[model samples]
Target: MHKLLPALLLAAAAALPVHAALPVADSQGEPLPTLAPMLEQTVPAVVNIFTRTRVPVQQNPLLADPFFRRFFDAPQQPRERIAQSLGSGVVMDAAKGYVVTNHHVINGADEISVHLADGRTLQAELVGSDPETDVAVVKVAAEKLSALQLADSDQLRVGDFVVAIGNPFGLGQTVTSGIVSAVGRSGLGIEGYEDFIQTDASINPGNSGGALVNLRGELVGINTAILSQSGGNVGIGFAIPINMAKEIMAQLVEHGEVRRGVLGAQAQDLTPELAQAFDLNAQRGAVVTQVTAGSPADKAGLKSGDIITHLNGRPVRDATDVRNVIGLLRIGQNVEMQVMRNGKPRTLNAMVEQPRATTVNGDKLHPRFAGAIIGDIVEGMPFYGKIEGVVVLEAEPGSPAWRSGLRKGDVIVQANRQDVADLASLRKVVRPNSPLLLNVQRREGALFILLQ
Candidate 1:
C-alpha cells in the first residue's frame, strides 16, 4: 500500500477537472483538485470536546487500612481528584443539538463542553454510551449548528478516498486525507464489538470521536483508534462504521442503553480441515458448535454441526462475523439465516429474544454466600450462551463473599462437587451452615472458590 499511494495520487490528479476561480491551480493557470470545497461544507460539523471527571486517588496500603488511618488520624473519606481530557465529536443533528462521539471520551465525565468551529463553547450532557462498541451521544442546547450528512458506509470499498477531520492533540480542527485500506475489519481486540474501517488517515490523540468523511463530505465513520506502538500514527488507523454507530445512537437516544439480543448459539470458525472432515466445499463460514435448548436457534430447528454461511443478507466470514451481526440486533427482531447442513444449503428464521434475569439474594442461600448477588447467565455476561451456569452479579467489598474470594462476573459451574447449571441446581446443592465449594470460571480460566 505504501508504494501504491503515489500512483493513486497521480491517477486522482489526472482525473481532476481544472477551474480558474479556485485559488489552488496548476502551472497552466487552471485550478487543481483540492478538498477545500468538501471540507468547507463538513468541517463545521466536527467539534472539539473537553471533559472533566472526578476519580478516586490511589493511596498507600497503610492509608487504606482503617486501623492505620485511625492511628494516624488520617482522613476517613477517600481523596478524589479531577481529571481532564480532550477529544472530538460530530454534530449529527443541528436542530436538536445532538453530537456523536466515542464512549471513552466522556466516560465518567463530570462536566462536558463542546466547542464549535465558530468559537462558541456550550455545556453538553451525555445521552447514552455503549462501551462495547465505544460509541456515545451527547446533547447540547444550541442553535445554528452544522450537521454532516451520513453516508452509506456499506458502499465504501478499498482504495476509496477519505478525509479525517478532528482536533488532534489539542491543535484545533486538523484535517488529514487518506484512502480506505480495508473494510469489515474485526478481531482486533480494540473493542468488544468491532467492524472497523481501516484507513491510512492520520488519527492521533484527541482524534477520538471525530468524523471520517468521503469525497462528497458525507460522514462514513467515527475515528476511534490508531494502531501504533509509539503512540503515534503510522499509516494504520481504525474507525467505527457510521451504520453501526447510527443504530447504537438511536437506541441510546431512545432507551438510554442498548438492548442487544441473543441467538443462543455458539460457533467456531470453519477451518479447512474442519470443512474437509465434514465433506464440504465451503471456503468461508462459521461451524455451529453448540445450541442451547429452548433457545431461538433450537426452536428454529438449528442443530449442532450446521455451518452458517450468511445472516440476513450479510456474508459470514468467520465466527466473529456471526457474533458481531447478532450482537447488534434489537430484541424481538426476526433473523433469517442461511446454513449448510449435511452438505446442503437451508434457510432458517428465528426471532431474537431477551435474556432472562433471574437473581437470588446470597444471604438467603447460605451464610457463606452472604453479601453477594448471584444470578442466571444472560447476554453481556462472560460466557453467555456458551456455558450454562450462574454468575456472581455483585460481591460487596469487605464482606463475607469478598473475603472468601468471590467476585462479580465469576461463573459458578459446580457447587458441592455437583454440576450446578442454574439457580435451582445451586439451591438444591447448598446446605445451611456448611462450607461452600464452588468451581468457578473467571474470564479465560477456571478455579475453585471455597467459602467456609
Candidate 2:
C-alpha cells in the first residue's frame, strides 16, 4: 500500500496543469525583471554561419561498360554539384575575429560566411576542427564585433538555468530557456568523445554551434544536438561544454588541428558478467580488453582484464570515460591510471604519445613500402573484423606497393616471420634489398607479399 500510494500520487501530480514563471506580479505591483537585459548582451554574440560545398556526383557503373560506352557514347563524368548549409556560431574574439561552432556545421565546406547581427557579412576562415569533440574554430577579418565570455562549465550544477541562442530552422536568432538536465553525460555515441551537458532547452534544427549561456551572460556551452522523435524540439537537447570547446579551439587556432594522446590500449565497458568473473565490488569501470604490446599502457604494466577505475584522479565510469580523458590530454603528457586487478587496486603511470609510423626512408626502406602511408589505428577508424594494427592509410598511384596488389585497409600482421603488430614494429622490420615477406590481413583472408 505504501508503494501504491506514491504511484497514485505521482499520477495525480502529472495530471495537474503546468504553471508559468512564478509571481507574475511582484509584491509592490511592479513586474519582475526579465531576461531581456541578459539576452541583449549574449544574442549579439551568436551569429549565423552560411557554408557552400562542392560535391562530385557519382556516375552509374553500367555507363562505364565498354559496349555501352562504344555504342551510346557515355556522357562525360557528372559535373560537380554545389550544396549549401546554415548553422549558428558564437563570437569568441572580436579583435582577432575568432568564432566557435560545431565541427559538423562547417564540415566539408569550401566557402564559409558569417552573418552578424548588425547587418554585416564577412567571409569566414576555418582555423581548425576536431570531430572527436565536434568543435571547430573559424576566423573572420571583421573588428569591433561582439564577443561572448566563457564561463567555467565545471562549476555548473544540475537545475541551473541556461539559455540557448541559435538560428534554429534558419529563423534568424531564437532564444529558449531551461535548466541543466544533467551533467557529465557520456556513452551516447553522439561523437567519438562525449562529455555533453544535457539540458531541457527547446533546441531544434540549425541550433548547432550556437551559444548556451547563463543568466550572467556568460557562455556555458554550445548547443550541438537534440533528442527528438518527430524532428522537432521536445525539450531534450545537448550542448558541448564550453570548457572542452575552448581546449579544442586553442589547439585548432594554433596548430590547425588537435593533437590527442594515445594510451595504446583497447577497452570496453565492464558488464555485470565481467564484474562477477573479476570479483569486483561494483560493475562500474572500463575493462582493458587488450593493450598494445609496446604502448604506454603496456609499458605501464596494464594487462588484459584490468578494470580501470580512475584516470589522472578522475573516476572512469566506462570505456568512453577512459577514451575521453585520454583523448583530451596532449601528446607527451604523463597520466596516472588506477585499475583493479584480482580484486586489488594498483596505479600505473604512462606517458601519453601520438601514434606515428616508424619511417624507414631512402635506400633502407622496403621497395614494397616505399610509397605506402602507414599509421597506428586511432579512434573512429573503420576496420574489418579487427581493432588494432598498423594499417595502410594510403598508397601512391602507380607506386610499387600500389602495383603489387597492396591496398589501403590492409593490416600488416607479420614481416619476414616477425610480428608486425603496429606502425612502430612494421618500420623496425622493413629494410631494403632484404627478403621481406609481409603477412597482411584483409577482408578476405591472410596472404603474404614478398619483396626483395
Residues 1-452, candidate 1, lDDT per residue (tens digit)?
Answer: 79999999999998888653646668898878889889999999999999999987777888889999899998876688889999999999999999999999999899999999999999999999998899999999998999999999989999999999999999999999999999999877688788999999899999999999999999999999999999999999999999999999999999988898888888999999999999999889999998989999999999999999999988999988888888888999999999999999999999989976799989989887889999998765435656888989899987888888898879899998899889999999998788889999876789998878
Residue pairs with clashing backbones, model 2: none
- At residue 46, give the lDDT of candidate 1: 99
Q: Which candidate tops lDDT? A: 1
> Model 1, residue 139: displacement in angstroms?
1.0
lDDT of 2 by residue, 1-452 (tens): 68799899999999987884568668999988899889988888999999999997776788757788778987656658899999999999888999999999999999999999987999998999987789999999987799998899988999999999999999999999999999888767677678899999889889999999999999999999988889899988999989888888888988999888778888889999989888887878999987878888899999998999999898888887787788778889999999998999999999987864343332235766667777666643434114456777777767787877678778878888888666677768877677788788876588988876
The CA lDDT of each predicted structure is 0.92, 0.85
Q: How accurate is candidate 2 locally (lDDT)?
A: 0.85
TM-scores for every predicted model? 0.82, 0.71
- Candidate 1 lDDT (Cα, whole model)? 0.92
